[model samples]
Target: MLKFLKQVTDYTKGAVDAARFIGQGLSVTFDHMQRRPVTVQYPYEKLIPSERYRGRIHFEFDKCISCEVCVRVCPINLPVVDWEFNKEAKKKKLKHYSIDFGVCIFCGNCVEYCPTNCLSMTEEYELAAYDRHELNYDNVALGRLPYKVTQDPMVTPLRELAYLPKGVMNPHDLPEGARRAGKLPEEILDEMKETQDGESEAASANAK
Candidate 1:
């Protein structure tokens, strides 16, 4: 009789615990139901992108030296460079620099390898087209500057390397000390500041 009574008591305790858990879950559900919805309406409303968001690629013709570094680094061979040597001028002139968005993976390799910092990924992600052929962009189209240039802190290292116009630096180029410290050197920081200032001045001039 004692064993049977103990079992009944244990069963009752288990039932009570289950009911308590169910009640707590229901309470949480009801509380959430009272809160405002967080859903965003597409086309009408849009969420702000994160700092490091990479979208469409943009090219600055003035800054590009027709180095063909972007074309060489593209994994999918999407970037096309058409240039010819000007024998009299002793320089290479860019005839056409194009990119096909249909095959572009947006891997950012082209932008990273660009020694002149002429190539960049803009935040214009709305790239829908009825004709696939329309997605291919030539130098005349891609060379247009964006209305607003996003400054991503994640690309601080890239901006710092802008000081060395003829040199290109990658993440692997960082010194062991700087890499371990997770901090940029004073010289790099100064160079970044100068680059920012120069870009701002250029933008202002363009606005005029």
Candidate 2:
């Protein structure tokens, strides 16, 4: 009789403890229910994100040298470089350059490998299209020239010469005779001076 009474007491204590735990759980759930929700309504308001975002790529055609630098670097071969004879100048010029956006991985390889500084990545990220072909770009249509450079008249003892665009790595620097063909204005001379100073500073720092 004494052992049975002890077991009953233990069982009763366990039941009370279970009831207390249930009450505490219910309290926590009720408290959460009374508070405001943290869910957001997307498309109406967006959260500001950090930088280091890789967006779409943009091409500056005029700066391109048709060297096939970007085309060769792209792992997917999305950038197509084509050219034909410019009858008026009797020189070969770019004919067709296109990129299929659908297959682009946004790896930035093409932009980095472009020798003419013709390719760059842009921050515009809304890339949506009903047809996949719409995402492609025509090189001639999109390849626009970048900034112009004026050479120094007094320095280097050579005539004023213009440098090629940023991304282009020319086979040979423009001939010295061609450099002397144009007279650089004061403003252009100043710009050239600034560029030279910047380059010198960069070189000095790199050596250090």
Q: Which is the leading candidate under lDDT? A: 1
The clash tally of candidate 2 reads 9
Q: Which ten residues in a row have the lowest lDDT in candidate 1?
A: 156-165
lDDT of 2 by residue, 32-108 (tens): 88764444343332222213345666677667777887877889777888888779988768767888778889898
Clashes of each: 0, 9
Q: Can you write out model 1's per-residue Cα lDDT over 1-208, one digit (the tens) per residue? A: 9999999999999999999999999999999887645554454444444346688899877777788888778887688888899999998888888898888989999999999898999866767899988889888778765533224332322222322223333322334334322334776899899999999999999999
Q: Give per-residue lDDT, candidate 2, residue 121.
A: 69
**Candidate 1: regions farther than 4 A off:** 1-38, 147-208
Model 1 residue 146 CA deviation in Å: 3.0
TM-scores for every predicted model: 0.55, 0.47
Q: Give model 1's TM-score versus the native structure.
A: 0.55
